[model samples]
Target: MTKVTDVVLNLIKIKGQKKEEAANTNERPPAKKQSPGELRLHKDIAELNLPKNTKVTFPNGKDDLMNIEVTLRPDEGYYVGGIFVFSFHVPHAYPHEPSKVRFITHPNIDLEGNVCLNILREDWKPVLNINTIIYGLNLLFIQPNHEDPLNHDAAVVLRDDPQKFQRDVQAAMLGGYVGQVYFPRCK
Candidate 1:
């Protein structure tokens, strides 16, 4: 009986050793590799020289390099003196793929926060940097394009009646009603 017990214990020990070895040998952990886009975003941030009244913050905190917030105060245009905030999400595929940007203002923002900027979407290329995007956003406010618009209504007004569109933009910036929605005073 004593010999049998010793044999049983040895068998158990051997089985446990086999299981441990199998786990160590068979498992391959997932690799962590930063994409080209992420590399570009990092480079862009490091090289950034922001303009006055233009601030950048990482809402997800510094530890998180993927998300960021950019606030703009245009010196000229209908959006002049207005504070507009934008959010940028850098996916793992970034630099190679354009960063996903969103406007996080009041609910008064168009249904899609669609910043109908050519540089941001159609004209985007690896050569473009954050500085370019910032400048483009400022341009959008200074000269809201009627021909190519994210907000159709705003575009229509801008195309059909430039004066009324300007008035509506001013009204919205001042925290008034352009239609049924009330915008917060950003100026």
Candidate 2:
């Protein structure tokens, strides 16, 4: 049973020798090892097999895969015919941790980019995959769960008056005024 101190000292010695070797060779150190988060992202991207309407893009270009943008174009629902974009940021823990997701363009999204979804919050589990999350996000546009909502006003309207809520969603998606708020045309 090696003591913690002994293990740390051994690691330091190895790192020091590696640094010296790199210095002598006039070579850069290897890229920082990918964290669990990065490894999961690589796997998610490869296995995505996204729907035709959905596209994933690395905004920082190919090398920076930790951050990505997912575009969703739902075929049906209040958001139908409109394009929605969501940004995903994978933390160092990756599959061990849920990816942070924000809506870039959605009628219901607040200015702060807070997204309302069960899987991204209380329902998250290691067994749930990217496909599940993406589908849940699309459901947000289609269903817009007004019961558990980050936007209280939207939820209130949705609960109190279903027709008006649908109208408001349509107006917002069409780049019209649902009141003082002006939503850009997403179609």
lDDT of model 2 at position 110: 63
Q: What does candidate 1 score on TM?
A: 0.74
Cα distance off (Å), candidate 2, residue 96: 2.2
User: What is the per-residue lDDT of model 2 for residues 1-187, given as tens digits with 9 covering 90 to 100?
Assistant: 5799899999999999998997879877666787777777788778887777788889999889978888999888777888878898877776767778886334346656778776777778877767777877877877877667776777788889988887887787778777676777877
lDDT of the candidates, in the order given:
0.74, 0.77
Candidate 1 lDDT trough over 10 residues, lowest sum: 103-112
Clashes of each: 3, 1
Model 1 agreement with the true structure over 1-187: per-residue lDDT tens digits: 9999999999999999998888789786544576676677788999988888689899988767788888999888667788998887877766656677776222223545656667767788878878777777767777777777667777787788888877887898888778876677887
Candidate number achieving the greatest TM-score relative to the actual structure: 2
lDDT score for residue 18 of model 1:
99
**Candidate 2 lDDT score at position 96:** 66
Model 2 earns a TM-score of 0.77
